[model samples]
Target: MGIVVALWAAILGALAVAKYRKEAEAERTRIRDMRVVYELQLSREIAARRRHEMTVESRIRRELESESQADTAEQVAALRHELASMRGHIEYAISNTADPRRELTAKPHGDVRELVVSDNAVTDADPGRTEQQHDQDVVDAEFETEYQPSAHAKTR
Candidate 1:
């Protein structure tokens, strides 16, 4: 009878060990599945964040390019205006002479007033202002009065 009781006790101990091993395996599997789910969520979140950052960077780049283009356009417009002012000055100088090409190329020998239209010689005989100063003043006045903004310039 004692031997029989000992054999029964060993059998019950073996069954208990097997049941514990099965439960442990099931717990391990549950933990592995949970870890996989968390990793997937983390990866999705990281991808979303990266996409947002890229979108923001793209927007900033576009804005910078637009500003650069606007600056370039403004500079072009200013250059055009300066060129127009210079053209008006040249036209004023040319119109005052009897022979535009000859007077422009020739040197003044006898009378400086005859070769070039001097403000001091023609209308304002201001003794204070020299011939060069009068010429500069005329140019300044003509630039102020005759400088018409081009269509592109007016829009700016």
Candidate 2:
């Protein structure tokens, strides 16, 4: 009876140890799975943060680009306005007859004979003068006069 009871005690102790070891292994596996899930969650959070940062940076770049384009447009508009003003000034200078000498020289005369005939014989009869010579003589005459005949000439 003693031998049987000792054998039964040994078997029961072995069974309890096996059951405890099994339960401990299952707990370890559960802890390992939980750790893996936590790591995955942390990685997901990091990825989301990176995506948000990228989005913000892209929006900033787009805004800066738009602002730069707007500035360029304003500069172009200002330049165009300046160009138009300069063109208008050039046109006015060309059209305004402030100097009678400049106007007379700009007129086409075939030669000195034609100029003398057109002037109604105001100067001496010099048939030897050419058109260019007559133009130079007119210019010299205008330079000799100190008093301006017109208001526009005085301003000039």
Candidate 3:
């Protein structure tokens, strides 16, 4: 009977130890899985941060690059092209609007006075004197006669 009881106690102890080992192994597996998940999450976060940093760095680099006139000659050429285009437009408009080479004479002054035409020698003045001078003299004489003050107004 004592031997049977001891054998039964030993069997129970072995079963308990086996159960404890299984539970410990399960806990270790759970912890390992949790560590794996944490490591994966950390790796993903680091990659995202690196990507963002690279993007921002590229944007900053682009902004700095824009400040420089790297293609100075090209830009100048483009501006010259634009100026030439504008000149072409202006030339086209001038050519289409009127005769570009035609000389434009200034309009003649108003003919307010009537001159009598006579083939006979009218005035023996210098031939160098122009008709405009004679007309101005005639206009002065006409203004004196036309704007003469009334006798009553003149006395006042």
Candidate 4:
């Protein structure tokens, strides 16, 4: 009887040991899996944060670029307007201005004989003319006061 009891006790102890080891191994596996799940969750959160930051930065940069372009456009428009105004004023002055060449030409020295002699001498010296004469003539014309296109000369 003692031998049979001892055998039974030894078998029970072995079963309990096996059950405890299996339970401990299962707990360890659960803990390891939990750690893996936590790491994955943490990585996902970090990725989401990066994406959100990038989106915000992109939006801000686009807005700033657009604003800069708008400012440049406005400045260009203003410069164009100023240039047009200056051009208009220049045209008005040109139309109203006296010819500088005409003003420089020697006036008749109030002596008819002297004027005739001078004119004759000058014409004789330049009997033959070239492109220089034309250019000088244009210069003279440019210096004359504005006159009616149809008028041959300014009235005395």
Candidate 5:
């Protein structure tokens, strides 16, 4: 009877040790899984924050670029308007002004014709009184004078 009771006591002690070891190993596994989940959550949060920052930076850059383009366009338009106004002012100045010398020199004189001789005449009065000489005499007149040569004659 003593031998049987001792064997039963030994078997009960072995079963209790196995149950305690199994429970401890299960607790350790649960702690490891929780740590893994916590790390995954932290990584997700970091990635989300980086994405948001990038989006904000991109939007800011686009806005600044658009504003700069608008400013450039406006300046170009203003310069074009100024150039058009200058052209108009120049045209008006050319149209409205008149030269008094041109008007005074345009009148014809009848007395100068009496001194001119035809090309066929051979007058011995003065060698310089011929038609060619007379034409040369009027060459020194004002450029705007009525006796000025035509455009075709000036080319020759």
Candidate 6:
């Protein structure tokens, strides 16, 4: 009877140890799974934050670029308007202005018969005309404002 009681006591002790080991292993496995889930959540949060920051930065840059473009367009339009006004003023002045050549040629001022006779004699004396002489002839023709001598000067 003593041997049987000792054997039963030993069996009960072994069973309690086995149950404690199994419960500890199950708790460790649950902790590991919870840690994995927490890590996944942290990584997702960080990625979402980065994506939001990038989107905000891109939006700000686009708005700034659009504003700059608008200012540039306004400046261009103002410059075009100024240019048009200047062109209108220039055209009006040109239309109102008289021809300088016509004004200079319209009035005769001095007796030039003696000068003409002398120029003709010199040109007849020199049959071979130089480029300088031809240029002078052209200038003289363009600016010829000869008037007849007054009766008082002719009498003198």
The model with the greatest lDDT is: 1
lDDT of 4 by residue, 1-156 (tens): 999999999999999999999999999999999999999999999999999999999999999999999999999999877766654554455454354222112236652212111112232345576656745764554322223242345442
List runs of model 2 lying over 4 Å from the truth: 1-9, 96-156
- Residue lDDT tens for model 6, 70-133: 9999999998777666545544443443431221111146532111111123344466877577
Model 2: how far residue 25 lies from native, Å: 1.0
Candidate 5 lDDT, 95-149, residue by residue in tens: 4434211111111475321222223433334865666665454444333223456
Residue 133 Cα positional deviation in candidate 2, in Å, after optimal superposition: 14
**lDDT (CA) per prediction:** 0.69, 0.66, 0.63, 0.64, 0.63, 0.63
Best by TM-score: 1
Question: For candidate 6, what is the TM-score?
Answer: 0.48
lDDT of 2: 0.66
Tens-digit lDDT track for model 3 on 14-125?
9999999999999999999999999999999999999999999999998877765567767888987776665455444434433222322223573322222223434335
* Per-residue accuracy of model 2 over 1-156 as CA lDDT, tens digit each: 999999999999999999999999999999999999999999999999999999999999999999999999999999877766654544454355443333322226553112111223433357776667766665444221223274446668
Error of 4 at 44 (Å): 1.9
- Please, what are the lDDT tens digits per residue for candidate 1 over residues 9-44? 999999999999999999999999999999999999
The C-alpha TM-scores of every prediction are 0.59, 0.51, 0.42, 0.53, 0.45, 0.48
**Residue pairs clashing, model 5:** none
- By TM-score: ranked, best first: 1, 4, 2, 6, 5, 3
Model 6 poorest 10 in a row by lDDT: 112-121
lDDT for 42 in candidate 5 is: 99
Supply every candidate's count of residue pairs whose N, Cα or C atoms clash at under 3 angstroms.
Answer: 0, 0, 0, 5, 0, 0
Ranking, lDDT, top scorer first? 1, 2, 4, 5, 6, 3
Cα RMSD (Å) between model 6 and the true structure? Answer: 18.9
